[model samples]
Target: MYELKTKENDSSVIEFIEAVENPKKREDAYKLLDIFTETSGYPAKMWGPSIIGFGKYHYKYPTGHEGDAPLVGFSPRKAKISLYFATGDTKREELLQNLGKHTSGKACVYINKIADIDVDVVKALITQSIEFLKETYPDQPE
Candidate 1:
């Protein structure tokens, strides 16, 4: 279990967003903040060191690993924004096709800039990812 150090609260989110030095990156971060808040209908909170997360879920795996994590979140790295989503679901491939310029790992989407991707497509991806996590981790609390 990855223990989140930051409390789930508004001050944390504000402080984290304020730390972004680049104006363009800061603006992108704010845009993401809006998208996540609206999509999840959950207040934004800071998760750990840098993740701006929305909502919460309690997850327990078959191997006995269990903990709470945000339903959706992103970290604005120096080079790109790392967007996280639950992996191992097949349905997300369709959304990826329309996400514009992005790279993917097992469960992360890397966007160099918000302008590089279609905002609507990214929003849909967030929605689908949240749904996928809920379905796969059914015991998780919304």
Candidate 2:
């Protein structure tokens, strides 16, 4: 039984953001909190120690592994801010074209700060991620 490390917790989302050592990261964290919340129409919650997540879905793999996860999230990290979106959504790749300056990973899209990217594009990414997750996991709670 594998454990999901990024489970949602009752921790203070603001406390985690405030603890970010970089003042700019802290500010960007606040900005992202609002963006994710407003775009996803889900309140932000603390996921694990560092992630601020909005919305949620339950997913089961073909191998029988299953867990609940945020529909979209972000973590303000040391080197850059990590934006979490649905991994394999073609819309993700499409939106990233207009996402301004950012780097992509398996699950996270990294950006230096809010100012470095187009906020509207981030909102689109959030929308697409939620829609993709909901459509893919329609049996799961949205």
Candidate 3:
């Protein structure tokens, strides 16, 4: 069986943030912690080693691979902060268009810092991601 390495764990989110080598990134991590927590109304939990996640959902693929994932999350990476959000929402790109300076992969949005992106827009994206995930995986327990 394949192991899910990124499962949520009992790790301390604050300790992880404080360990970030970059002082500025560490500070931004706290800012994001507040943003995600307040926006999702869920306490932040450590996902894997560095991802600070809020809320969660379980998903099963057609191939039968299944696991739980954060409904919204972000990580303060070495190069840039990676904001995790649900893909496939039409409003995603629309909001990103106004989200200040940032780059997007399929699921992660990379930003230099919280100051580089609009905090309000980030909150909006978090809201949309949670709603989309709730609807997409309606069977997930609260």
Q: Tell me model 2's lDDT, rounded to 2 decimals.
A: 0.92
Candidate 3 to truth, TM:
0.97
Better of 1 and 3 by lDDT: 3
The number of the candidate with the highest lDDT is 3
Per TM-score, the best of the predicted structures is: 3
**Candidate 3 lDDT over residue span 28-138, tens digit each:** 999999989999999999999888899999999999999999999999999999999999889888999999999999999999988888999999999999988888899
Instruction: Tell me the tens digit of each residue's lDDT in model 2 across 1-142.
Output: 7899999999999889989999989999999998888889999998888888998899989999999899999999999999999988787999999999999989999999899999999999999999999999998744
Look at candidate 3 and give me any clashing residue pairs.
none
Candidate 1 residue-pair clash tally: 0
Show how many residue pairs clash in every candidate, following the order shown.
0, 0, 0
TM-score of each: 0.88, 0.97, 0.97
Model 2 vs. true fold: TM: 0.97
Model 3 has an lDDT value of 0.93
lDDT score of model 1? 0.82
Q: What is the RMSD, in Å, between candidate 2 and the native fold over all Cα?
A: 0.9
Q: What lDDT would each prediction earn against the true structure?
A: 0.82, 0.92, 0.93
